[model samples]
Target: MPTGTISKRSVDAANPESKDWLLWDDDLPGFGLKVTPAGGKVYVFQYRLARPGQAERTPARRYTIGKHGKLTPDQARKRAKDLAALVAQGIDPRQQEIDAIAAEDEAARVAAEQARLEGELAFENVAATWLDHYENEKGRRPSSVRQAKLVVNNHLKPRLQGKPMPHISRSDLQPVIDAIPAKQRGMRRSVFAYASILFGWAHKRGDIPDNPLASMVKPQAPKARDRVLDDAELVFVWQASAKLTDPFGPFFRLLILTGQRRSEVAAINWAELDRSTATWTIPADRAKNDVAHIVPLSKPVIAELDQLALAEQIKAEEEKPDGKRWPKSGFALTTTGRTPISGITKAKNALDAAISEAREKQPLPAWRIHDLRRTLATGFQRMGVRFEVTEAVLNHVSGAKSGVAGIYQRHDWHDEKRAALESWAAHIEAIVSKKQKDSKVVPIRAAL
Candidate 1:
């Protein structure tokens, strides 16, 4: 090492005498310029650690300041003095650098840990979040939103509940696909689609860096079911419903009698029905089309609703206290009256059992609760109900009323709707009355 005031000219002129060497700055001790064998010059600061009680200087530690040309001699001297000040204060610049690096590493570790915990977001958690967004945040159809929840609860969460987002791979979901029955291919496809959409939502929100199911090929398209119940099945549905208990029985009858969706009929609140006018008004939020719907309550529909209301009133009376009674739930088809009747699968199973028990030789064909809605729509078309009127009764926004026609044709067909439902109800009554008389003479046959 050579000691001197390191100048730009001197530094540029300095040569490595057959090897790399350091030229120390005399003005600022321990600060020097190194001349490499390749003729590159860089500034460096060198110092020894301080001792507590011992007089001897500890081992020296070196710190690189900057390059020669990048930081001029003056700049390097100023930086070197600042570092020398640290040394004089009994601080090790090298230890500070090491501590700074360690601190940075620790911070990075903590960040990584936080990210890891956040990444632990499971399929069930994301499903709930997605439902919240669907119901509360976005203007989505309630039916579709409910379907998403059903898909998550019945299909998704049961399979992929606790698994972390990133750790869930394609293979992780294979069992879910395989477990679905072959007959429910449509449902299997729907579950996959719902999961795919949910995971995609999580990915877009940066909850997960990537969607595991993004590259997954969707399940094969299911065979479309257009099986509508005929006149005989309608009779069987009407008659067999009597065997089912309260709420479920009336619920089934209303599905056929009103020609409305299962959810629509089941979700009817007492307040929604006007006993004077015999009309049920479904709010825009509850309607599948996102529009308010008015359903004319025919004699049969009104009778069932009155019966349910009476039962609720009796229940309220029974649960009454000293000169005070709690009001019953506003729901039309609720066992608890507080919440609408759910666990439809169990209800359907009970209906199936009753149907089987009613007709000994033959049972009703495998049909969904939605099939009753389809049956009503088919029956309406068969009974000479106008297309627009039937569409109004069903609350459907398709066909001639789908596009611009829907915007222009604002006529709610209030009178026509009432007539249509009345006609459908009378038609159903004829079928039921005919079946009652012919029950003993004829044997129950499967739908043709």
Candidate 2:
């Protein structure tokens, strides 16, 4: 007899002292609720497979039934009946009960938090709020971001991203900074520096407590790429452009004429072009500084697009079943009318192949395709193009202005830029035959 449960006889006796006579007054030796000597009522369960006179029971388990306050008497009895059925089924009723409780706990834990969908929301509510506000919002997985993340996730985040974002300081970043190659380290530093800023941004919004980047040191930039492409290398790129068919041919030519980034040219959409005006409008979203840019399309740029338009119209007429008659590189890059090339990968393949083509012919100084822009600038400088005028042509923000004046002078610079680019385009056209030469299969050495 225990102190809690009152027997029916005790109720009939109308005496509280009779509670000691209750059947469930003590911890239940088998299953269901019980009462303790101190009068605390609790659910209890005990299970065995054999009677003492029978064969010894296999190992049995015990588990809680439920607190008396939590489970009504009738409810506890029903649970006890269920346990008895399990015991009849040759199951250790107590072990099943314990297993059930463990399973419930595990389910609750899983439901409490689900795995995060990383690509969702672009930036917020998903990616650990790790990058930028807008990028997380609008950007997709591109080469640049992919490359940058690989470094941070591999080298930095395992060490720092989970720490209090504000607690990341210069000392924490110093190890990665010092280990990077002397020439390639600036970008690595920029990644963490940007990360620190992002974490700080989160902190300011009360998402975090401190900015580790506040005291973080920026890694010094490695050697600058100052090498200018020589005239022979320049001519070789153009000549290679001539030998290549459709899109690659025209793309390299456009790159040489406009001196814009390859990605800028590759992703060009028809909406961005004003053919009549011989100009292209680059939306702020696409530009590095997020400023709108207007490029005055040179004759070569327009002429090249004109060829694409013709091919596109003709291809539309000749219509194939696959899909839209995509240009060589869709948007800005086009090969014929039917197929559109996409992504940095495809566009880069074109450039790399073209570079290999050029190398075979002339074997000029080693250089990357991006050097074309600097080469054009340097060529223009040599051609007596004014530095500021060339910079304007390049749509670069001038260093002289400060603050709101910069906002006021967003520096479209189209008019002067047009003239400057035309001058350089004329210089390039003289050497590379975008018009004079056509794609003829000639041996690289023989052509050279």
Q: Which candidate comes out best when scored by lDDT? A: 1
The segments of candidate 1 whose C-alpha lies over 4 angstroms from its true place after superposition are 1-107, 110-128, 131-135, 138-150, 153-163, 167-175, 210-214, 317-329, 435-448
Q: List the residue pairs that clash in candidate 2.
A: 2-25, 122-136, 123-136, 166-210, 326-338, 328-334, 328-335, 329-333, 329-334
- For each candidate, give its TM-score against the true structure: 0.69, 0.59
Question: Over 4 Å off in model 2, which ranges?
Answer: 1-11, 15-180, 201-214, 243-246, 318-330, 334-363, 400-413, 433-448
Give the C-alpha miss distance for residue 327 in model 2, angstroms.
10
When summed lDDT is taken over every stretch of 10 residues in candidate 2, the lowest stretch is 438-447
* lDDT (0 to 1) per candidate: 0.78, 0.61
- Judged by lDDT against the true structure, how good is candidate 2? 0.61
* lDDT (tens digit, per residue) of candidate 1 on 148-227: 88888887788777777766778987778778997888888888887888888888988778887778877888877777
